[model samples]
Target: MSGPAMFSRYEFMIAWRYLRARRSEGGVSVMTWISLIGIALGVMALIATLAVRAGFRAEFVDTVLGANAHSTVYMVPQRIENDLTDEVYVVAGRIQDYDGMAQKVADLPGVTRAAAVVRGQVMASAHDKSNVAEVYGIGKADLEAMPRIVDPATLRGDVAQFGPGIAIGAGIARELSVSVGDKIRLIAPEGARTAFGTTPRVNSYEIGFIFNSGRYDVDRTRIYMPLDEAQSYFNREGVADEIEVFVDDPEQVADWTLPLLRTVGEGAQVWTWRDASSSFLAALDMEDDVMFVILSVLVLIASMNITSGLVMLVKNKGRDIGILRTMGLTEGAVLRVFFLCGAFTGVLGTIIGVILGVMLALNVESIMAGLNALTDGGAWQPEVRGIYRLPAELRAWDIFRAVGLSLTLSFIVTIFPARRAARMNPVEALRYE
Candidate 1:
């Protein structure tokens, strides 16, 4: 404290004293603590919101990818009669020798599984209920090839033999008021031609299993049956519509494009999960980014409070600033003291807020459940398996972005008030005293 080396140390001490002062002692005012609280609240809100966003993103990706393929290989569209069923023909763009193609593509590097599938639309009815259905023409082999379609634990009934039975989604079962072992009728537009006219065909299939993927859309509309049965029913036999491919890492689906294209050759076009649902995926990414921007605005607002609080503080400390200047304190040191006073609020708040936010985000599910229980509202426990709980993920980048932006804004806000403090007039300050 006696030497020139003590200049910065004295500045810190003076700042600390100002921060710890009571109202009568000309110390930190209530407004300073209020500003700190505001900054902390803003930071906590940002981190928790980002964690929720990340959690939802992961849940959606997992749920969707479970029921759908990572990528699909399709050949040019073609119209042909599956069999000698009727006068009219079925239009199907199916890959020629798809089994061989699927096998070849499966042999490619990074390819985990490939299955030839036939897809068609129909109206299914049972137990006085009807709904539009998407029939996936997949056999035991295809089911074995793609494990994401159904979990062994959730699946019910026998599917080993297939035996003209359908594996239906749980939502569809509920809608039709039917479960495993119930018979459902599928109505196809294609039928045998007669002297009167062409008639629609109706085929009956027994429900073998009910699968719940937690995806409402898929559960309510999609059904799986043997490929051969589907081709025969749709009057399009001997060819499959497309080959669905699965890989090791779905996040890297984009990276597998070139290798997949080269392996399958030019006759067919390949579509990745990203390509098939570009708008949906884009919407998720954009939503995350949009939320980040919005929350950053809140932090900026909180930083403004820091500027305002410090400005009020500087006005109250004018005599102190003048006295320090006359005691050999440099203007630069005076400037630094006020800057530290403001910056300290932001730094401390950010640190405390980070701890609180992480704890909140990680236990969001429990918090939601507790709130629900307290309110007698069971909204947290949804009936659907996939959407039952809140998901929270605290990513490093998200934390860094939020904390860094907050600190930067706080640092920027402190400059004007600090500069004003340094330029105070000792004579004018003392005359009032």
Candidate 2:
């Protein structure tokens, strides 16, 4: 029976009997079911939490890219002149350069649009009302391409009128009590001086449109005007404060940014939206790492349960082990039998967990929709401090890592208990039984 011999009918019977008995009423205790449930719940929680975080990241990134370009090129100290034309026409020429550079940048791989932008802090006044806001000067065509300024359904007038018109945010519109066709006076920081010291040089313009992009910060503080009008009003010539570049592939921002910087040379600085919001990105990275460690502890706890269950199985089957050894089964064969049993538990648990995880991740949106309905849809309301809904992104890497760790932990858990079973003494066990 030792060499090239099939397993005896009795050996097969023994394995089958143990397997069937384990599956029956006496196989696992009440505690085992509790452990399995805990594992399932833990897996579900991790999947849901990660998905929501991922969703928020995706949404915010889109908002930022919509408002700002994928990358920005601006001068350090942001000078508007280069030793020319009373520093006035120099600024104007710089503003005009936006159109040319935008064309050039658009020709680069992945760049969709390039627009010159003039941004400045200005006081906007209408009648007896006044508010401080950031004025963004952009070409009418470019403004149409900008998401923050292109919500046609919410607009009071067309953005393409190309007159001395501006688009204000919905929040700004509310605060100023202003609407399309209303006139607002813009006063720049640099004002002309009269005999009575400094007189505020202001230009009145018609509000051509209003847009709301669901972002409170932008909607409350931003105003858009044509680039030429903005430069003239600001008394800047042949120069712009910054050049905003939109890309076809936002993921290629770093790639586009470096080359553009080389082209612009040391006169300018290149920045991505990621750089604009470093604090938030850092927080996201830290949150993701902390979640990974915490969820892994859950898997560890599950592995511990597997370890304990296998140990109990080993203890219960000691007499069987002894009998098999006395019946000419080698120590290696004895070890293999118990090892197979322990491995089976881990493999079975992992398979079940993976199937469950995939289902939950894939259907997370539908599940949230149902939950919202159950709560009378109140869950869709805005949150003062957090995103309203959860987002789950199931990357292949996450699945591979989870499965690999669970299986490895299960195998590790079984080793000590399986070894203990293999080293049982046949004589003592037979005498006791």
Q: lDDT tens string, model 2, 114-199?
A: 88888888888887888888988887778788775586665667776546578887778888898888988888767665687766
**TM-scores of all predicted structures:** 0.86, 0.77
For model 1, residues 1-433, the per-residue Cα lDDT tens digits are 6546534787888888888857574435676777788889888999999998888778778876888889888876545654666555644466768789889888987888899888888889997789889999986877755444557876777666365578888878888888788899888776656798877889889998888775667878888988888888876678888989888898888887787788777766788888866887798799888988988888888888888878878888888888988988877888889998988988988887788789889998898888888977565544443454578989999899878988998889998899999998878877878
Cα displacement (Å) at residue 243, model 1: 0.5
TM-score of 2: 0.77
Give the Cα lDDT of each candidate: 0.81, 0.71
Can you tell me which runs of candidate 1 are displaced by over 4 Å?
1-8, 25-28, 79-90, 145-148, 152-164, 191-198, 258-267, 366-390
Q: Output the worst ten-in-a-row residue range by lDDT, candidate 2.
A: 87-96
* Clash list (residue pairs), candidate 1: 21-27, 82-236, 82-237
Instruction: Judge candidate 1 at residue 390 and give its lDDT.
Output: 70
